[model samples]
Target chain A: MLSIRNLTADVDGKAILNGLDLEVKPGEVHAIMGPNGSGKSTLAHVLAGRDGYSVSGGEVEFEGQSLLDLEPEERAARGIFLAFQYPVELPGVNNAHFLKEALNAQRRARGESELDSVAFLKLIKEKIAQVSMQPELIKRPVNAGFSGGEKKRNEILQMAVFEPKLAILDETDSGLDIDALRTVSDGVNAIRSPERAIVLVTHYQRLLDYIEPDVVHVLAGGRIVRTGDKALAKELESKGYGWLTGRDEAA
Target chain B: MTTGEQRATDLEKVLRRGQQQLAAGSAADNWLSAVRERGASDVMTMARPDRKQEAWRYTPTSFLDKAEYAPVVEGPFGAIQPADVEELMLGDQQGTCLVFVNGYYAPALSRLAPGQHMPQVAVLSGQLGDVPAQLKAHLDGIAEHHHVFAALNSALMSDGALLYVPRSASVQAPIEILHVSVGLDEPGICHPRHLIVLEEGAQAQVIERYCALGEAVYFTNALVEIILRPGSRLSHERLQEESALAQHLSDLHVRLDEGSRYKHVSATLGGAWSRTDLRLNFAGEGAQADLDGLMLARDKQLNDVHLDIQHTAPGCISRESFKGILDGRGKVVFDGRILVAQDAQQTDASLSNHNLMLSRSAEVDTKPQLEIYADDVKCSHGTTVGELDHNMLFYLRSRGIPSARARQMLCQGFAEEILDRIENPALHGRATRLLTERLMTYSE
Candidate 1:
């Protein structure tokens, strides 16, 4: 339900994403695998509508609407979620309070009834435990003292709460251990449904073992060079992307 | 002498009061008379502070024109009271609620509050008999010998809040004192003195609020002294929502005895020129003190606070933290020093002052000092001044919060330290609302 055409972006006057294009339909899982400098995180940040980046040339459409014309909050209201590679630490805003504010903002934008504090507290008790998160974590300032894994799990918990139509997971499994990886992958898989689409951005084929993707695209030199089914991931894991892309393994 | 001549000639209208009470006064009254005369003579001698003085290093007195100020002997607005402001004052004693028409106490317009533990207040002049002896003894004792304005306050002081707590007695609720100034006639002056004595094992909370009622050219010189006996606890809050054109100078001295505790918080929101000098003396073992202050200045305003915390006994602890947020060319200065004496070992002290300057023209200067004479003591201090972090702003915006709202939330977070100390949830909610209001006002 998302289409990216000729996405060319620049950060601090250096080109990062060059002529990147991709698409996914509802109920489909797309995995974009690339080398270190393959611009995986840039695509996620660009789609998330983060500032300080100049979108040189690109057309991003979500559900037949132009995404570039919308603000970040507007994008969130339209069911677009980006699980950040590194979560921010809001020192004074409580984690539960932050989530409640975001939820209410989206609900208000959509003319839906919003949940109050009592209802939100009841909502978190179950959702936090579903991801094995400690109940006290919600009471502390947002990500103030959270570990790397707890922060990622919190991102997933937010995804579950918002139930976004499209989720772009950016290196959500990079720093996780095998146990954390399984938990995160299971969390993502648990939310899989016919009406939702998943875009998994990663540097390895290890996470593909848990939540299999319908399509795997090989990205090199800031652009996608190859697209294939799930076996392509295993082939690349065994042979690497240098053979098919004909580029030096510089990054 | 020419300007002083004009000032004295002008105050002849106000200083003419108290000739009768002046005939029959206490020993402290005689001392106050001498102090006031010294203030009149030294109005020129009390030089505006420069950067050369150690205590005035971070604070420059370029804005204060000593020549423009004259000693005021009486309240200017004799019989006028503004309808815009409300005074919800309470005291622990029983007496007339001595009101002020301008800066002068109008004993006629004032009446006594209800019962015991309700404030007993009156003008120090006409009805001084009902007040306890301790009140009269120390009413003029809180002012430091060297403070020009404080000594001036003692001299021509119109009226003040005098309190005395017997041993082991605690005032249940907060005691609020409001000093309102009304009229635009001539540049006038007000000296409000307060003396709070907490006997052994007594506890109390006192809040002092000052607000200017009119466009009158005025100055407020105030002195408050708190004496906490052994095992006594006291909390004092000082708030200033004065008019933009007014000048304010305040000095507070607190002496805590063995095992006594004192907590003080000051919030300065408005004033063209506002300065506070505070000193906390821990003279007995196991005494503790915590001083938390927050100030928000905007629109070319100025706010300055200087504090000294001295540990004279062993096993004493003190924490001093003050923060400021400056916008629109406004300036702020916070200078705090903590002194640990030779015998004051096992002392734990920390002082920090942080500022957020929203504009390039807005300025904030902070100095945190520690002088430790004993070994094996824990002492630390730090000061930071900076603009907003763009990364944090961007992070908030990317999460669906608008850029303006993101800035507001981040600024509120910067101010959260002081807001967290508000004990009551309703009060906390009010502080949060004020922070957000400042954000919006800054935006406009």
Candidate 2:
């Protein structure tokens, strides 16, 4: 469902992702684990076509189309979703109104009928229940004054509502507690289907415990150096990334 | 003479002409004649506002010289139907509606509540011969005539709306004063003054709207005076949506008595050149005032708001917030000043002005001033002029909304910060719709 071949990207003329290559088929879940300063979050942002993250060289393909050439909104309409690590606060944009506009925009781009407010409310209520988010939160401004846990759940709720085919979870569990992690993981697991692909970009293996991944890849210095099953995460948690990156921790 | 003196002389001539036009239709009442004469003399002696003046530095009044504006006489009032102005009415207000067309009261278009439970309403022009003593006292003493436009409004004032709430009466419905300016053959001008008085312990809401019928080259000089008696509360909402070819100038004066409360929200969305001067005075102890404003200017339009708040009594509080959205070479100015007198101990006040520029050439000039003479007082002020947050923009676009729509939403959201303060849902909805419509016209 997604392919990245020697993806070379830079941020402000500083190379972050150098010659990184990855590929995934439909319905598979891949976990990319790394330490701080690794290009895990950069890779997710590059796929989502965020501005200022220039692709120096290489190609990223999604469903046989060049994803790097598309705008962020275009990528989103083509079923590419990136759940941000730090969700931005929109001070006066209603949470429900924003979600509805997003859903309708994507639907319109794909030649589908738009949902009215009543239908949208009903759909969003169901999604809110799926993510275990407080229904009242949707009435307030998007992410404004929201707790960290509530913001993470809001991201999950948006994911469930958008139902993107290729979803990249960018450190969605960073600020979440154990209970929130379980709720988020449950929300993610419920959206799992044979027609979708999920890529979990995380720093630690804590999130993988609740929703196990089929493949785990260790990213260091902008490239994936190790690939294994779920056991690789546990091994990394115990030994740390020093052995793989050839840098000793005590140094 | 220098150019400043030359312009001043020219403006004085214009004011004299307007005064003559008003005197030609003079009523028989000596008191009314004296008011007009006082206003005319006050404006005749004062020099025209120039760029060198502190209050008019950023705003240029040069456009007034280019047009010959004659006073609008008793009517050729346009043949307007109720349906033409149906959209301008607030949906929730079911009390009284006073409609004035081209500075003259249109009784056929107005509706007053049937029973005696409503506040006393009258037209100023009709009451010139037999003016009530209470009306005369309040009208003569409600506001000062120091402002140039306020004096101009007084000199040219022919008709207006008068509202009086008796003591201890809590008015449930809102009173709406709708002023519609219709395009005339000549470039005309009108001065519509409004006086609202709430007796002790009385509560009421007043909505004052100024709208244009078409693309008319006219000027609307308006003045509003509000007097809140001790323990009284008043909510005033002013909406100005004039024509693009029109010029609008307004003055608002509010006096709050002991323990009285005053809330004001103004939205300025139209007119090529518009300015509003608001002065609020806390006369008695423990009074509170909240002032909020939202303005939009684009395509060379200039919008200006000048506010002066005086805390003259102990234990008084005042808050002022104003926001502006400018695009397409538009210019906006916000000058807010607060004064806490020496005798006004334990005073609390804050003022803030924020502007969002959508175009490279758009400009905003904001000044927040605080003069505290009391030892025990809390006073703070802040101002910001910036463009849209790129981070917030990207966040919205990343959610599948297009770039243009995303920008529109962000601008509307910024405006909602002020519009949300309108507690009346119908008025809030109307303000939101007007802001949205204005934003849509802006170039993306």
Candidate 3:
């Protein structure tokens, strides 16, 4: 369960998200569609607790607890996962090692026993299979020289391993080919369960074809203008967001 | 210029304290008395190292603060390495094993590698070798060059180590010298001196290590003199890793004879305030000298490396390369030089120093100098200091890797280039462990 009550956020004092509100329950998939400047990516950053974003107004509650007060790492420890639109490339940091550290850090923060190298490796090997990633790729520096589609898929793989309670996908499909999109959606669908919720942020309806959303919200002018069903996504894909909102947008 | 202008600065206070401590002991108890008697009252007078001093320019001597210095210590340096520390602090190379504890040679903790041709390593902890017949001409001859520390080392060396290789003998194994400066409860001062001689056509490898243990605040005034006979080839490595609680001073004097090949590599990863002054000279034609150094400094650590290469003979080649990575409030200074004598024609030399600063607070100063009087000589020098590549960082972050983790990996990669130069597996592993620890602690 999650709630955003008139949430307002800004980067370097410039407002990016203004009075935006959205909610999702267990097992529900919600998609937010917006044009270039519709604050789509800003929502993902705010939910992930990225720094440099000042919350000038409003509040955000995740599972009945205020989320704005938590740190990015703290939110991560609490099972709030955001698939970064741009994953960082770590030169000498092995992918498997990085994942293991992240997993162990979260575990340590949550008062759980840390997994040794052997057990962690076995678990990641299985997750890599689910995401159709190779073991060697996991051994190399995290996403070093990785293709754009591979980076997007790796984000999903990490989400699978962490098993976050609320998964926020931020334009994860932008760089993916059709096949990659299908595989990524398949990976997302496999992790879908009644105890977790998924928030999908995208402008294209193509991802909706893989894992159809229960609700589709139209975001414009830094606010949520409309909330509709899956058919609404198909309607926007055909007519575009121009008829939906006659606002000035770069894209 | 005038004695009145030279007041007792802070560094002098510390040095005088050392002098008094040395004087209190009987001549029979100490070996450096003759040299201590020759102590310079005007440590400040001779200590005038202004920006005009080429080697002292990049590294502002003002950093030492003519005042804020502590006294040298006299006991076991406290636990610098953690209890669960990695096993390979020193590699498993075969040869005579020389160990130094708090600048004092610790003979109990060393074991020489079993080899028929390997040179015997002996501890001159108190008195050095009475000049040997074969190396007598070159011994101390190279030590008399220009370093004030070398002069002081020649005058006061309490205890040291000696490695002697007979003429025409080829040693395949490496000789290891390990120094552990205890910096805990009992602290005073430690002066470690090492003398290595390779006879004509002899071949050998030697490793010099300075590790600080515990929390002792002391002085490690170390001098290692290396002499290579004609046609001899020697491989040497020096490692300095101290905690952020002590002062380290090390000087190396290296000389190569005609047709001899000499290589010296130093990996400096940690210290509170440390300086490595390396002076190398080529005496004969066709001789070669290669010097390489690496430093990883974090926190408020200050690391300075100064190198002077002199080519006095024609047909000689000398190369120098150094790299430094600074983080936290750490500061690093590097100075390298190549000198070609007027008659030394056909001399080839190259010098380069590169630095990477990971933190805004971290600073680095690097200078590479080349002086050539022989028109037929070929010489070049370069120095570069900058931060990590932004494009490389962006490339890593684009792959879903967190920004923090990505930055860390890039730092490690930059260090790996230097660590890979080592051929010995054990040595590589030990240095890697130290390098990784430095990077991790600095990033946080």
Candidate 4:
């Protein structure tokens, strides 16, 4: 469903992603694990087409189309979703209104009929329960004065509402307690289907415990150095990334 | 003579012609005659404001010189239908409406709640027996003597709405005053003086609306005087949506007694040139005042707002917030001044001015001044001028909203702080719609 080939990118003229390559097929769940400053978040941002990132070389393909050339909104319309680590706090903007606007925008771009307020409210209410968010929070401004857990759940609520084909979860478990972590993971697992591809970029292996991935990749120094199955996470958790890097050097 | 003096000579002709025209419409009433003549002489004494003056530095009054001014003739456009006045009404405020066309009251277009339940409402010139003493006492009290436009309004003012609430009267419904200007063969002018008084423990809400019926080259000089007694409360809203060729100038003077509350919202959406001067004085202790304004100027339109609040007594609180959205070479000028006297201890005052510039050529000038003689007082002022936040734009765009829709939402959000303060839901909705329509006309 998604492919990245030698993705050479820089932030502020400093190379962050150097000749990184990855590929994901339909209905597969992949986890990209790395230590701090290992370019995990940069890959998420680059895929989302965020500004201020200069791509020195390489290209990204999504469903056989060049994704790097599209704008952020175009990428979103084309079923590319990035659950941000830090959801922006938009003052004076109602959460429900924003979500509805986003949903309608995607619908219009896909040549589908837009949902009215009544229909949207019904749909969002069910999703609201799916993420276990308080209904009143939907009426308040987006993420303004929201708790850390609430903001993460709000992001998942948006993801569940949009129902993207390719969902990129970037550090979705950060700042979440154990109970919230379980709820969010269950919500993500419930939405998984044969037609969707999930890419989880995380620093720790704790999130993988709830929603087990079919493939595990360790990203070190801006490139994928190790690939294995679910057992690899447990092995890495016990032995640590230093063991992997030493073996890589020896090899 | 100095340039200031020379400019005054040329302005005097236009003001004098208006005074003569006003005199031709009125009867031989001693008190009314005396007030008009004194007003005319006051125009000569104050002359006209020039660029040299600090208050008029940013606003150029040269457009007044280019047009000849004549007083609107009486009964030339016949009577106005209530339907015509309804177009300018805010939402569904059907309580009481007083309509004035070309500075003359139209009884057919005006409505009042049946019977004694209605507060005392009358025209200034129609009834003289009970109005003379009150008019004489408060007419010249609020507006300063040096303002050239106020002086001109006082000189040539013919008729206006007068509302008085008795002691302990709590008016639930809002009273609306609509001033409509019709097309004229010559450039015309109207000076309407409004007087509102709330007695002790009284409460009331008033909306003053100014709009033009057709394409007219006219000038509307409006003066509003409000006196709130001890423990009284008043909410005053002024909405101006005049013709593109119209020029509007208004002076608002408010005096608050002990434990009184006064709130004002000024929304300026139209007019070629508009200026409103608001002066508030806290005469007794424990008074509260809030001044909020929102202005939209486009296509060479200019909106100027000047506000002055004086904390003369102890334990008074005052707040001033004004915002402007300028596009298409439009301009806005906001000058706010707060004064805390020595005897006025424990005073709290804050002033803020924010402007959003949609076009590179659009201009905004904001100046805030605070003078505190009391050692124990809290006063602060801030101003900001910038475009929409790029980060916010990207955030919205990332959610699949188009760039233009994102910018519009942010701009509307920036303005909602002031517009949301409108208590009437219908009025609030209408005003929001009007602001959006006005914004869509400007090329991004």
Candidate 5:
């Protein structure tokens, strides 16, 4: 479903994703794990087409179209979704209104008729229940004054609503308690289908227990060092990344 | 001559014209005549507002040099139709609308609700022959006439709306004062002075709206004085939407007695050059006042708001929040000051001014000042001038919304923070609609 070849990106003239390559197919889940400053988040951002990150050398193909040249909205219209690590707080933008506008925008871009308010409310209510988010939260401003767990759940709600072809979860498990982790995992697991691909970017193996991955890749020096199965996650958790990168565990 | 000297000369010419108009419409009442004479003399002697003065530093006075304004004595009231006034009426008003075209009361377009409990509503021009003692006492007394524009308004005051609520009467419907400035053949100016008085234990809501009819060079110098007696409450909303070729200047003075409450919302959405000077004075203890303002300036328009809040009695509280959205090369100035007298113990006051610049060239000068002379008082002031958050923009765009729509949504959100403060649903909806339409035209 997604392919990246020789993705060499820079942020402010400093290399982040250096010669990185990854591939994922439909109906599969991939886990990209790395230490701090290993370009895990940068990979997700680059895929989402965020500004200020100059892609010096990259050939990211989604389905069959080149993704590098598309704007963020264009990418979104093509069913690419990035669940932010830290969700932004829109002070005065209502969550439900924003979600409806976003859904309609994507629908309009695909030449589909937009959903009316009644239809949107019904759809959003069902999705909110799937993610176990309070219905009133959507009535308030988007993520404003929301708790950390609530923010993550809100992002999952958005992902469920969008139903993107490819979903990139960047550090979605961080700052979540055991209960929130299970809820988020359940939400993600429910949306797993043969036509959708999910990529989980994390720093720990805890999330893998709830939502098992088809493959795990260890990112070191901005490149994939190892690709293994679910058991590799446990092994790395027991033995820190020091063994994989030949550096101190604390570092 | 330098620019200042030229401006001074232009102001003198305008004042001289205003004096002649006042004499032509001479009133038999000596009190009003004396007031007009004093105001005219004050304008003659007072130094014309120049950049050298602190108050007029950011506000450009070159517009005054554009023409020697002809006082609007006899307006073409017949030119305005009922439908024209109907289009501008607020949805929630209780048909107590007084329409003024070119500073003259349009009786055909005006309506007063038939109710025994309704407040006394009259036109200033109609009552000038037999000026009521109560009206004369609070007309020029409420607002300080030291301001040059206020003095100018008093000097050439032609017509306005007067609202009087008796003691313990809670007015059910909002009183709507719609001031319509119709473009004439020459550069015209109108001074409409509004006086609203609420007796003890009275409650009322008033909406003062200023709208223009044509795209002509006109000036609207308006003054609204509000007096709240003990245990009284008033909610006032001022909406200024003038023509592109028009200049608007207004002064709003409010006096709060003991245990009174005042809520004010001012929205300046359209004008070439607009300035509003608002003052709130706490005369008795346990009074509270809340002020919220929103200004949108684009396409070289200049919008300025100066707020002065004084706490003279103990146990008084005041809160002020003002926001501005500027695009193009537009400029906005926010100067808010709060003062707590020495005897005003336990005063709680806070002021905040925030500006969002949509263009690189748009400018904002925000100054929030607090002068606390009381030993035991809580006072704070803050100001912020910033551009739209890029992260917020990115987050919106990443959700399939276009970049331009995302920016518009964000700017609307920034304005919604203040528009939400309008408790009246109809007025709030109108303001939101106007702002949304204005923000859509903004260039990315």
Candidate 6:
């Protein structure tokens, strides 16, 4: 479903992702594990078409089409979603209003009729329950004065509503408590399907326990060093990334 | 005479053209006649404010120098339709209504509430049915003192709305005053005066609106004075929507006594050049004041807002916030000052002025000042001028919304805060619709 061939990118002229390569097929879930500053978030940004990232070398393709040539909104309309680790708070913009606009925009792009407020509200009510978020929060401004856990749950809610073809979660579990972690995991697990692919980028293997991945890849020095089955996650959790690399401490 | 002296004399000669005509001509023995005479003399000597003055530093005075103005002699309430006035009226609002056309009272269009003992509502030239004898004592008490515009408005003062709520009375319904200006053969001027007095423990809500009926060059100079006695509460909303060729100027002065509260919201949405000068004075202890303003300027329009707040007693609180959104080479100026007196200990005050520029040529000059003499007071003043947030733009785009639509949504949200501050639902909804329509048609 996706392919990255010797992809190299830089932020502010400093190389972050150097010669990174990866492949994922439909109906597969891949977990990428890396230590701090291992270019985990950089890979996610490159795929999502965020600005300020320069692609120095190589190419990325999705379904036989070059992904780097598309704009951020264009990629989003094509069913590519990126759940930001730190969702931006927009003051005075209602969450429900923003989500309805987003959903209708994607529908219009797909040559479908737009949903009115009554119909959109009915559909969003169901998704709101799936993510276990208070309906009142949806009426308030988008993530303004929201707690960290609520922000993560709101991201998951968007993922469920969007139903993207490829979902990329970047450090989404960093600021969640145990209860919030389980609720977020449940939300993610419920959205898993055979026709969709998801990429999980994290430093801990605890999330792997709730939503198990079909494959695990070790990322070090901005490249995928090793690829193995689910057992590889447990090995890395026990020995840490320092055990795989020869360094005394993990970056 | 020297050149400078000759020029000054010529300016004074021009300023006295309309000083002798009084719309509601009263007895010479009446106190109002003396005020008019004083105001006219003041205008003759005191020069019009220029850019060199600190208060008028950022606002241009070239527009005021274009043509000579004469008093608008109530031109026969010509071709004005009630439907037009109805369209501008607050939807389904139940209140006492007073309609004026070119500063003349329109009896057929005005409606008086059906209450025998409520507040007195009448035109300045009509009988004051239930008003107290002290009404004259409070007139011109706290205007933009010594300003040429205020003096000019006082010099040609005509019929206006007079509302006075007695002591301990609660006026449940709001008082609505609509000043409609229609075009004339040549450029004309109208001066509308208003006086609102809420006695001790009295409460009321008032809405004063200024609108234009045609696209012709005219001048509207209005004055509003409000006094809140001990333990009184008042909410005042002023909306100005004139034609693109019209120039509107207004001065608002509010005085709060012990344990009183006053809330004010002013919006300047139309006109070629618009200015609303506001002054608020906290006279007694434990008083609270709130001043909120919004301005939308487009198409070479210029909107200037100046606010001055004074805290004279201890344990007083005041908050002032003004916002502007300018597009299409529009210009806006905001100068806000808050002063805490020496004995006003434990006073709390905050002032904020925010501006958003939608075009590179759009101009916004904002200055927020705080002058504090009391050591135990808490005061803060801040000013911000910038474009839309990049993160907010990217977030909306990442959700598949177009860039233009995303910006529109953000701009609407930015302006929605002021509208939401209005407590009246009907007024809030109407302003929201108006603002939304403007935002839809506006583009950078």
Which candidate number would show the highest TM-score if scored against the true structure?
Answer: 2
True lDDT of residue B418, candidate 2: 88
Candidate achieving higher lDDT, 1 or 2 = 2
Better of 1 and 5 by lDDT: 5
Q: Provide TM-scores for the models.
A: 0.85, 0.96, 0.73, 0.92, 0.96, 0.92
lDDT of each: 0.75, 0.87, 0.74, 0.84, 0.87, 0.83
TM-score (C-alpha) between model 5 and the true structure: 0.96
A best-first ranking of the candidates according to their DockQ comes to 2, 5, 6, 4, 1, 3
Tell me the tens digit of each residue's lDDT in model 1 across B31-80: 35654665545443554456777766765554344424444445344544
True contacts kept of 6: 0.58
The complex in candidate 2 yields a DockQ of: 0.82
lDDT of 2 by residue, A56-121 (tens): 898899999888888889989989888999999998899999999999999998889999999998
Write down the RMSD of all candidates, one decimal each. Answer: 4.8, 2.9, 7.1, 3.9, 2.8, 3.9
Q: For residues B263-288, write the lDDT of model 4, one tens digit per residue.
A: 88878988899998888999999999
Backbone clashes in model 2, listed as residue pairs:
none
lDDT of 4 by residue, A1-251 (tens): 89999998999988989899999987899999987777999999899888888888988999999998888888888888888888878776778989999999989998899999999999999999998989999998888899999999998999999998889999999989999999889888978999899999988889999999989998888888899999988888877787766543211
Q: How accurate is candidate 3 locally (lDDT)?
A: 0.74
Chain B: TM-scores of all predictions: 0.83, 0.94, 0.84, 0.93, 0.94, 0.93
Chain A TM-scores, per candidate, are 0.96, 0.98, 0.97, 0.97, 0.98, 0.97
> Candidate 1 at residue A11, lDDT?
91
Model 4: residues with Cα > 4 Å off, grouped in runs: A239-251, B1-10, B28-30, B84-86, B127-137
Backbone atom clashes (below 3 Å) for every candidate: 5, 0, 33, 0, 0, 0
The top-ranked prediction according to DockQ is 2
Question: What lDDT tens digits, residue by residue, belong to model 2 across residues B1-444?
Answer: 113332222546657776676667646335566677777887877777889889999988887676666777775764678888786677867778899998888877787877845577877887423555676678846667766767777776778888889899988888889999888876677889888999999999988888888788788889988999999999998889899889998888899999999999999989999999999999999999999999899889999999989899999999999999999989999999999999999999999999999998988989999998999998999999999998888888888999988999999889988888887788788889888887887675
lDDT of 6: 0.83
Q: Rank the candidates by lDDT, best first.
A: 5, 2, 4, 6, 1, 3
Candidate that beats the other on TM-score, 2 or 4, i.e. the better one: 2
